[model samples]
Target: MFFSKLSYTLGLCCLAAGTILQNGQVRTTNYPDIKIDVASYRFRTYDANATEISYKGRWDSKKVSWWSAPGLVFGFTGDTVAITFGDLTTDTTLVGYRIGGMDWSFTNVSAGATHLFVSSATPGVHETWPFNPLPFELRVTNWAYGVQIAQVHVAEGESLVRIPPHQRTIEFIGDSLSAGMYTSFEGLSSFAYGVGAGLGDTEYYVTAYPGICVSDQNCWGNPRGQAHQWFYTSDTSWRASTIWGDAPEPWDFERQETTPDIVVINLGTNDNNSANNVSTATYVDAYTKLIQGIHGKYPKAQVIVMQLWMGFYASGNSYAQNQGYEQELKDIVAYFNSDEYLSAPLVWDGATNTTTKLDAPSEPFVSYFSTRGIMQHNDIGPAWHPTDVGAIKVASHLSQFIKLTFGWELVATGPEIFHETLYWNDEQNY
Candidate 1:
């Protein structure tokens, strides 16, 4: 299901210019540090008049709290605080924030309406609240360069420190599908977060550049610059040797150290077009060389070659023509496997229909719908990045595969485990 309007509220005491808000009190610090801010709103629904809110959990327990408001400021605080919401006679919205404890709960929130939650993290765990069966959108930002602590649901007595950061990190590289183009808030729910949460030991990153082909040689040159512009930052550049000879320098692929334990490359869809119909043989050779180049940099990284979803061609075409191109790409993976130098295997199991059409009412395709409805599309954030939901689905799929392939134990609670099971079934349908 998709939500139209949702709100999140966090009771916070803001500090004077450049001050910090902590323990429900505003204080100033000597050095510059990062903080989280939160904001929530209550939407009017049919049952709004009678909705109730309550907080349940151990008081003073060390836990992560999130907050968001206008602008992009978000923060987390650690202190004992009480949360209250609800109208005595009718349902009203109640919102508050806790400095650093869990022991809290809100009850009788109006059903059937989605709610939005936004939170940020500086150097600690950053999370968005109202996570279960989310009925609204969630936006999270991490400003602190250092990694922070963040978890969706904490066990009854477990502390935040006890939960470990994801062990395996997977990076997705490709165009819109891999970037999650044309998705909605609900679709974002199925994104990498959910997948990481499911695997219990994996983190996922989407480095997809919309409309970018596998080789720069095929890109529109000069003024247009192709979609490659989306992938490169002022600090980092991605030049496939098959197109630009040696790797482009001055740009830092090393500092972008967002490198993954596993890298899934899903480009080439755009490269298979009319102007760039370099024979499948030539494309495979180039793609294989590209894989070798990545391996040269990250020898331990596993590379997965992905196929197109549904939009590679026009709506009416049955996708037969592209299927052959896809097979040749698979052959490239086989060639790499034959080489003793490349130890990592290419993953090709999660291909499915594009999330764009699945969201439409006319689709009637519930069986394969990602947990958040659409699977691989981004609703917001960078032009074609996966929306939160789409990222969750990819993360979930990759996480499960990593866990099973690497024999990692599942650490999430029973309910979360079940959620992964449901997601797995949906992937099977694909």
Candidate 2:
């Protein structure tokens, strides 16, 4: 059975008390429903390219399973704010928040133009009274389904104001690892710990496809293509590069918000899956194309091709004969870091193993680069994906890399970082 979850206290407040006399007469103000452009909010760690914006005046996110749109925070001032969206299938599960900080879930809701309202009062009771305009923020916990956000609204008489988006943004593109698959949900999934929590100020966008490859067919009998999930709305037969063409309705990227300053790619694990029979040269060529494509879209962005987390091949296969996937990733990084620039390229030679230190420094970035060091397989999740702790470990490594490479230092001793490290280290056997 499906259930809704709330992470904050639900204090009982009387609706009649919303407006009380203080100095003079009663004042009642109603604001118009504020239409927020979904493109205005930063996707944060999501693949901004894969997003389908302006699709019939909606923001439709087509991502893989387990992907969450976490950093979409917007502020509206009203007695009641309603989130309106279009289309909902059995696959869609939308979890959102209200002013009092309670989570309300909408599952298998409805299709085509539906509005879910969050009021200052409890559900099933409607008592309209006078109240001042208060700013409230709401966010979507997950987007496993293809749900299109049409607009955010307040009452017709109420006003809905817009909050500015975050400043620094990063996009993560890869397979299940980047998708936070099997990562703990509410401390149950393996990597449930907050790896991305430390970057609370920064917006993140994640575009990861489980069991997907950059160029070869997925080992799991899924789609077969390049990392087109980076540009398309959903993981379907549609090509992200061509979805705009031959469309009665098309998504315009020019209207989309947030061009990433940094892009992290963790692929090839599925490409190297034994069933694919892909060669190193072919893999490198596909990987190069993926980077080129991303750079082509955002020329000023920095790219980091991550090493595969597992040394094993697909479905009980080992990388013993294929010279190991770690070496292959290192080789790709070497090619990208070659003497293209006059200065000696900062190359990650796959030196460190799974765990990485916070202060670790990679080679200086010339162009887009690759990461070394194979992620640990011992601490994998039930589906053989990165555990919650493993995800944090990987995030920690990336956190370190981003800090050193971009000179963006993170708060190492903060509670988020400390507790994440402590809990993961104390529990993760891998």
Best-performing candidate as measured by TM-score: 2
Quantify all predictions' global Cα lDDT against the true fold.
Answer: 0.33, 0.44
Candidate 1 regions exceeding 4 Å error are 1-165, 186-197, 218-259, 275-282, 311-324, 340-399, 408-430
lDDT of 1 by residue, 253-292 (tens): 4543245676666656556655544465555654655564
TM-score attained by model 1? 0.42
In candidate 2 the C-alpha lDDT for residue 322 amounts to 21
Please name the candidate that would achieve the greatest lDDT relative to the true structure. Answer: 2
Candidate 2 is scored at a TM of: 0.61
**Model 1: lowest-lDDT 10 consecutive positions:** 7-16
Q: In model 1, state the lDDT of residue 181.
A: 34
Model 2 C-alpha lDDT per residue in residues 1-430, reported as the tens digit of each score: 0001110011001111222111234434222233344344322221223132112112344311223433234444445554545433222333333332222322222234434345456442242222123334333333233344444455555554444445766766666555544343321121212334455455556655455677644444445444444554444322222333333122234554667678777677667666666777777766766665565455567777665545334445533212236666666666655654213222111111122222323332323333334344455544555545566666666676677778776642432332223332466666
Segments of candidate 2 deviating more than 4 angstroms: 1-58, 61-72, 88-92, 96-117, 121-144, 186-197, 216-219, 237-253, 311-324, 341-378, 411-430
lDDT, residue 237, candidate 1? 18
